[model samples]
Target: MEKIAIIGSGNVAWHLCKGLQNEHIEISGVYSKTFANSQAFAREFGLEVYQDLEMLNKAEVDLVLVAVNDDQTARLIEQIAAHHKVAYTSGSVNLKDIDHPQVGVFYPLQSFTKGKKVNLFEVPFFIEAKNMELGEQLFDLAWKLSRKVEYADSNTRSELHLAAVFANNFTNHMYSLSKELLENSKGKFEHLLPLIFNAVDKLKNSAPEDIQTGPARRNDEQIIAQHLDKLEGDKKEIYKIISSSIQKKYHEKL
Candidate 1:
């Protein structure tokens, strides 16, 4: 097991540390700008905590995982470049932005929350590196943490991130809006839980196009109009746009 240091103590850092710890990897220490966060994470993982970047210079670690926010990733990489091999957990950042030759991406394509246990071994990891040798090393590190690992170039990773935003983030936004609408109607939002689960369940074995069912799919202008009439304010406009887009997609299929 290789010794590892993590540069951030946020959700990604927490989950990564937990996964690595479970695999009996050597977590040398964790660093955070705030002592509180670093202490908390270190206590959880039973590793040392470094509060200062300079202190990390003395820590014995093979690789540093920069799990900071996307904007801070590049700067953090630069700070750690002189000390150890570094990798970031960002889905959108390109490795070229960092100066380290051993720099790579160890992006886990899942939303992480502290205290909420996620099975990291089941999550997909997208790895990228500056060279093949570094890429293989990063892949091995990722394989230690996950069973599903893929080597994707920056461009492909960027596209995957965009698709993920649509599939996960935007869809979650839609769910929030639906819940809000249901609450406004004096109905329990939980009523939609089964439908949401079933919709996702269908995707396991069915293509979205083949499983899609809506007024737009049937070209039922009457039902569409009724739905639009039920919606109010900006929601009505959103419904119109989404219905039109869905109709267009299904029409193209026809």
Candidate 2:
């Protein structure tokens, strides 16, 4: 595609625009439900800003990237699919659910935060299209943005999205809880930074199952009891559930 128009000026759009610009791909303009955001993003990128969906639908672009929220994505793609080649960036949105022939998925399997630049070269791009021709086109386009590109259908993409929630969202929540506990005990969260880094670094060489530690993994009842006694409410409940799961998984190995 020679020129592409992007919908939504959120975190995904912010990073995508940068990645496309780096590859010298011409982004026709950007459109958003919020006019101020569209103006700001367009001004930042030196591109045209479309005031409404109707205006964007008539734009001279080969592809339109729907980088909006998952709930709004299908509706937006449905509106513009007839005019331009459409691809969305949602991992959970089923391709078949959208009744469009030219629709596809260009899901980036990474969490994006505005102003926090990530290495798009390493982020995985999952492509799914209605037909082989559109699929191949998206694959080629994704390859330009990242080294890791794979053709995954809606089901596989949905599974990957679930895994990502556990790996990234749940893990980050754990870190947040750890920080809260440390603060309550008058301990510095920074002191645990090295330990956290070491735990993650070890996973690079060994599977999580093989590298399991802690009282729960070791099946040390006394230590587990002691730890559990220190926690209360939802934290205590979470600890109980996760510890039980870990103990069960490592039961044979222990």
Candidate 3:
């Protein structure tokens, strides 16, 4: 796309704008319900600010990229699809749910935090469009930011999103839990960083199941009982559920 307009000024929007501009693509402007947000975002990137949705609809641009919350994505698409070719950055929002002619998905499959720069080239970009022409355009747009681009339908995108929750969200929660336990026991979470890095490093080449170690992986009942004795409430239940799952996976009696 030669010129693009952006909706929402959140983390995803911020990163996309940065990536697009790095490739010398012109951003027509940005729009947000809260004008101040768009103003600030535009100021930071030297872009024009669209004060209202009407102004955005009238802008001259090749595409409108919507990068907002999943729930709000469809509503915005419904409003703007007639005015411009639109794409949203949500994996869970189904494309069929929106009855639009020129709309698509441009989901970047990676966690984003404001001010934290990540290697966009390494992140997977999942594309979904109503037709092959639009699909190719979205793929070309994504390829400007990342080498990993693939077309995925709503069902496959939803499945990938679910897997992301387990791989990133749930794993981060486990780290938070580890920090809590460490602090309660007068230990530092940093002490476990090396171990965490080591485990992640192994995943580059080794199968997780094949390389698994620890009391649960070994079916060491005595150590498992000791760990359970130290945990309480939801933590204890979580431990039990996961340990039981691991044992079952290994064909070991619980």
Which residue runs of candidate 2 sit more than 4 Å off their true CA positions?
252-254
Q: What is the lDDT of candidate 3?
A: 0.92
Query: How big is the positional error of residue 119 in model 2, measured in Å on the Cα after superposition?
Result: 1.0
After the best TM-score superposition of candidate 3, give how far the Cα of residue 37 lies from its true spot, in angstroms.
1.5
TM-score of each: 0.93, 0.96, 0.96
- lDDT comparison, 1 vs 3, better candidate: 3
Per-candidate clashes, comma-separated: 0, 0, 0
lDDT of 1 by residue, 25-76 (tens): 8889999888998998889888888878888877777888889998888877
Model 2, residue pairs in steric clash = none
| Model 1 C-alpha RMSD to native | 1.8
Task: Encode model 2's per-residue lDDT on 1-254: one tens digit a residue.
Answer: 78999999999999999999999999999999999999999999999999988998878898999999999988878778485889999989999999777999999999999989899999999999998888899999999999999999899999999999999999999999888888767689999999999999999999888988998888899998998999998889989999999988879555
Q: How many clashing pairs in candidate 2?
A: 0
39, model 3: CA deviation in Å? 1.7
